[model samples]
Target: MQWEIVVGLETHTQLTTESKIFSGASTAFGAEPNAQACAVDLALPGVLPVMNKAAVQRAIQFGLAVGAKVAEHSVFARKNYFYPDLPKGYQISQFEIPVVQGGTVSFLLGDQMKTVRLVRAHLEEDAGKSLHEDFAGQSGIDLNRAGTPLLEIVTEPDMRSAEEAVAYAKTLHTLVTWLGICDGNMQEGSFRCDANVSVRPKGESKLGTRCEIKNLNSFKFLQAAILYEAQRQIEIIEDGGVIKQETRLYDPDRNETRSMRSKEDSEDYRYFPDPDLPPLMISPEWVEQVRSEMPELPGQKQARYTGDLGLSEYDAVTLTASRAMTDYFESALAVAGADKAKPLANWLLGEFSASLNRDDKTPAESPIAPELMAALVKRVVDGTLNNKTAKVVFAALWEGKYSDVDACVKGEGLEQISDSGAVEKMIDDVLAAHPGPVAEYKAGKEASFNFLVGQIMRAARGKANPAQVNEILKAKLS
Candidate 1:
């Protein structure tokens, strides 16, 4: 029997504000434990919580970016929970009234564009980290992250496959980062997701018992965890065993999920409006101001890249995936011109991405300047260096030492060998060595022609102009 997977995601994105949500403490990561924590963050008695204006502004910015309803009045509620990491014993979050509601994020699943509906995005305070190391028997609690501002974005169960869920998550991550509402740093726990997954018979209307996978920080893991869990649930139900609704943790090393605990329902939290803080009232003027300042989102940027820049749909989507990459691409294109767009796209997505992967750095941390990349593209276009030689120059540029493309080309002696005499001599040597192949080519064998081309390229050590070599070889053979 065919099974259908139903998936929903609750993503927690830390706001990019400089200060904590309810305290004057710094929200910086990697600080000394408890150094950034203030009295309010410690949840000390007599310390009242004050909302950060910047956090509210960022939430509004997100609402504007996604075309969601920005509520003029929103309230914070106390989510009662007990853990070593939660200092206040109850987290201040939104329950019934959230800041943003009813937005949709559209993304591509291959050639099809699918829209995932966002139920709501609410403001809340982050819990602290529990350290399991450096203690023989007891764990340590670091309150540094406590009371940090977070935007919990909950999406409707619109995805069917794990790939779809991951694609949707990545799209939302890019959107939040591009809108400057969040940093979207998955490694530092700045951005995280909890996926609720279930499996039912293909035509079954009622949902199956679902499991929630917690703290998935990467896209690959998110896909794998959901897939593993869905298969496991399907197997259990097929074997005549009922599926249990529980919380699971993804063990990436094992490529499986383990049950953590039974999933808690909403009523278990006993959510009540926080008495310490009043309802947040944002004026329409504030929302409009943020809306006017909202940058071009990924969807709009993708359309512009394809329509205005004349890039392929694939290239446009890839280039507009991140705001930093898009900015770098445009800056380089402006200097390189429209004629160099396809080549620039290839180099950025190919060589540039390879370097980024090798160095484990993001586009924001790219060492090569856009102007320098443009210069390299210009060198290739103007024939100062061939495509093969430009790769070497690109490596130098990526190391941040090469200031001039001309100087690098000259220093590396990578000038294209366009001399007809030199190319003809090399082609003559190849023809003399491979008479049978030359005869085969003369007899209309296409493979022999490619073989001869490879020999010519090897003879020139990738320095010869390929088109010119092909022309000269054909003329000499004729």
Candidate 2:
């Protein structure tokens, strides 16, 4: 029987705040196992939790960026659970009512635009880490991360394939980083994904039982986990076995997900409003303030690039893929004139991109600063150097062989000879020498013209402007 794969994602985005959500404890990564944990994080006797205003502001910023409704009042609920890592025995999270109510996240899957409807993005605290390694059959608990601020963004089951799920995850990562709300670093656990995967008959309307794969940090792992889980469910159903609703852990080494525990619904957690904290409140003025302070979104920037700057949609999309890329392009544009936008785009997307990949550095980290990039492209625009010579100058700048573009061109003598007289001399000499080919041209061999043009450029040691060589050579021949 034909089967259809369904997927949804719950992304935990650690807010870019210096402290934890409910305490003043430091949220910096790589601290000693318990060095950063405070009394509140430890759930000490008579200790109370206090909300971080910065975290709330970040949530509001995210809400505004996604066009979600920022609720005027939201409440924090205690999710009762027992684990060594969860010191409080109950995690403070938003339930019944969340801060960011509803929105849509859209991304490109190949050439088609796919949008995943957002159920809610709620604020919550993260649990600490459990260390099972480097111990003699004993487990260690680290509470430093217990109170970290996280915005749990939940999506509906709208994705149909592993590829689509990956695309959605990438788009969400970019958005969070672009908004400056989250660092979006998967390696450090700043961003984590829980994928709910299931499979049903292709024509079936009702959803099948889903098994949640927990804590997929990388996009590659997410794709692999979803593919494996979906196949597992399909096989079970095909064999007349029931698909169980449970939480599973993906083993990247083995490339499969193993059942962790039975998945719990809202009721199973025994959620209730926290007594220590009152209902979180927001006002229209506050939402407006955050909205006013929001940066121009990626979609807005893409539209401006295509509609106003006359860039192709593909170019606009490529340029705005990340904040670093867009900043680099704009910084170079600011240095180079607006009239050279197309030329600058070409260089940025082509030579610059290839160089960055080869060097394994981001555009922001490139040794050739945007100003220097602009200087090189400007030389090309002004005909000081042709494309070939401009690349030579670019390489020299990247290698730190020369500091200024003009100096590099001058020191290397790489400038194109655009002077008509200089090019004419070279062309005249070429015509005087290559008589056989010149004769062939007069005998109506059109290829001979190209041959003579190459000879002229060679005679000038490739410094002669190509356009000048072609024009003067044709005139002398005529």
Candidate 3:
């Protein structure tokens, strides 16, 4: 029997607030072990937790972005648990009523659009880190992240393959970072995913026993972990063994998952509403205010690029893949004029993208400024330079050797020879000098025509406008 994989992702997104969710402690990353942890984060006696207004606002912003219903009233519950890093002995989180509910995350899987239904997104405090390294047979606990704000966005089991799961993760990452709510930095643990994967018989209505892969920070690891976990479950089922539901950890070195512990259910957490904190209330007016402040979402931008800008669907999608890239393209387009959208898009997606990748930089980090890029494209459009010569100027601009497009063209002597008279003179010289090839062309040898054009371009020292050269060469030969 064939098995089908099912996946659901629970993403913990660290809010971009300067302080922890329920405390005044700093939320900045990479501080000394416990320097950022305050009395509230340390759970010291006589300390009470206070909610961060910025964290709540960010959660509302995300809710509106995903078209989810932001709850007017929600409750905070204490998730009772005991771990070395959990200073409070229980985590403050949402239980039955979360802040956001019933949303969908849509992404492109190749050319096909796939959407994952979100169950809920709740505001929670992140646990601290347990350090095992640099200690000899002992562990250390750092509570700096104990009270950090996180939006736990949970999704339904809507994915059938590892590729679909990865696509969903990447789309979510782009959206969160675009919203400015989260940095979406997997390296710093700002955004982490826990994938619940299972394998069931094809066409079966019943779900199989699922295992949660904990804290996959990388998309490549998420995909690899899911694939490995699915195969592991399938092999067990095929061998007439039962699949146990547990939490597993992915070892990148081995490319496999090892069971950490049995998976726990809601009942296991012993959740109860906190007495110190009142019911969280959100007004309809507040939601509307947040909705009004939201930036144009990716979907909205994609539609506008295709409909108003007349860009191809693929081009629009590629341009809107990241906020930084979209900003770069739009800024260049504004300077280059609206009619230059196609060329601007091509440069951004083609040469600029390749250069960025080669240098291991993002569009935001590129040396080529938007105005400079616009100027370069404008020169090509106005026939001041052909594509080949324009690239020389582009290289000089990228290397910071030239700040102005015109200066670079003049300094390098790479300007296109667009003067009709000058180009005609050169072509006439080429035809006169190459009599044998010209005679062969007049005798119906079509290949000689290309040879004559090459000679004319060589005569122009490679700066002649190719289109003008071809047009004039064909006319003179006729």
Candidate 4:
């Protein structure tokens, strides 16, 4: 029997508030083990936790950005659990009432637009890390991540495939980072995906037993882990075995998930409202204030780029993929002018993006300024540098070999031969070398003219203007 995959995701986004949720400890990454954990984070006796205003504001900003309702009154609860990394023996989270509710995350899967409905996005404090590698059979607890603020965005089991799950996860990642609520860095553990995957017979009303794949930090792993887990369930069911509801870990190197423990239900955690913290209250004015300060979201920017700026759908999607990429595109567009937006986008996504990835650099760390990139695109707009020569100039500037495109072009003598007389001579030289193509063109073979142009460009060392070469070659053959 054929089986269908069912998937859902719980994405934990670490907010970028300068401090932890209920404490004054620094939320910065890469700190010494446990140094950033304060007495409040460690759950010291006689210490009461206080909510951070900035963290709530960040959550409010996310709700507004997604067109979700921000809860006026939300409560924090203690999630009782025993783990090495959890110092408080219970996590502070939102259970009965969450801060943000009823949002949709949409993404393009091929030609179709798919949306994943969010169950709720709740505010919570993160658990610390359990380091087992350096302890030599013993484990160490690092409380640096403890008390860190996280907006746990949970989605309904609306996803039908692993690809759709990944797309939804990526869209959520982009949205959180674009809103500036979270940094969305997977490497430093700022963003994570907990995927619930299962397989059931097609057309079944009831859902199959799912296993949670925990802590998928990268998209590649997120997809692979879900697919592997789904297949594992299908194989077990087909073999007359049972699919258990458990939590699993994605071993990226092995490209599979192994059972970590049985999945817990709400009652397992023994969740209760925290007595130390009062019921959280948010006012309409606070939501309005955050909405006022919000930037244009990815969907809005994409629409503007495609509808207002006349960019292609693909180009618009690419340009507005992230806040940083959108800023970079517009920064260069500002310097280059609106008329050059198309080429500017093409270069940004094509050669410019390739250069950055090839050299392992980010848009922020790029040595070439936006103005310099604008200059490079402007050169392509004019006849000074053709497309091929522009790439050469970009390569040089990317390598720090030249300070500017003009310098690179002049240094490499790659100036396009736009002069009619100079281009005519090059075409004449090509005609003299190849008599067969000239005769074929004279006999009304129209395609041979392209060959003659290529010969002309080759002779001119890719410096011949393509339009000029086409015009010059036609004239020479005529």
What is the Å distance of residue 14 in model 2 from its true position? 0.4
Question: How do all models score by TM-score?
Answer: 0.92, 0.91, 0.93, 0.95
In candidate 1, what residue range of length 10 has the lowest lDDT sum?
396-405
Per residue, candidate 1 scores C-alpha lDDT tens digits across 215-272 of: 9999989999999999999889889999888999999999999999999998999999
Candidate 4 residues lying further than 4 Å off, grouped into runs, are: 441-447, 475-478
User: Model 1's lDDT to the true fold?
Assistant: 0.90
Clashing pairs in 1: none
RMSD of each: 2.4, 2.8, 2.4, 1.9
For lDDT, the strongest prediction is 3
Give one digit per residue, the lDDT tens place, for model 3 in 375-439: 99999898888877888898999999999999999999998888899999898888889999988
Ranking by lDDT: 3, 2, 1, 4
The residue-by-residue lDDT of candidate 4 on 174-217, one tens digit each, is: 88988888999999999999999988899997999989999999
* lDDT agreement with native, every candidate: 0.90, 0.91, 0.93, 0.89
Tens digit of per-residue lDDT, candidate 2, span 1-478: 8999999999999999999999999999998899999999999999999999999999999888778999999999999999989988999999999999999887767777788999999999999999999899999998889999999999999999999999989888888999999999999999999999988889888999999999999999999999999988888888889998999999999999999999999899999999999999999999899889999888798889888889987788788888999999999999997788889999999999999999999989998999999989898888788877888888889899988999999999987888888788778788888899999999999999999987877777777778777777777788
The deviation in Å at residue 18 for candidate 3 is 1.3
Superpose all Cα atoms of candidate 4 onto the true structure and report the RMSD in Å to 1 decimal.
Answer: 1.9
Q: Which ten residues in a row have the lowest lDDT in candidate 4?
A: 469-478
Best by TM-score: 4
Q: Among all windows of ten consecutive residues in candidate 2, which has the lowest summed lDDT?
A: 456-465
Q: After the best TM-score superposition of candidate 4, give how far the Cα of residue 371 lies from its true spot, in angstroms.
A: 1.1
Each prediction's total of clashing residue pairs, residues at least 3 apart in sequence or on different chains, is: 0, 0, 0, 0
In model 1, what lDDT does residue 377 have?
88
For residue 455, give model 1's deviation from the true position in Å.
Answer: 3.2
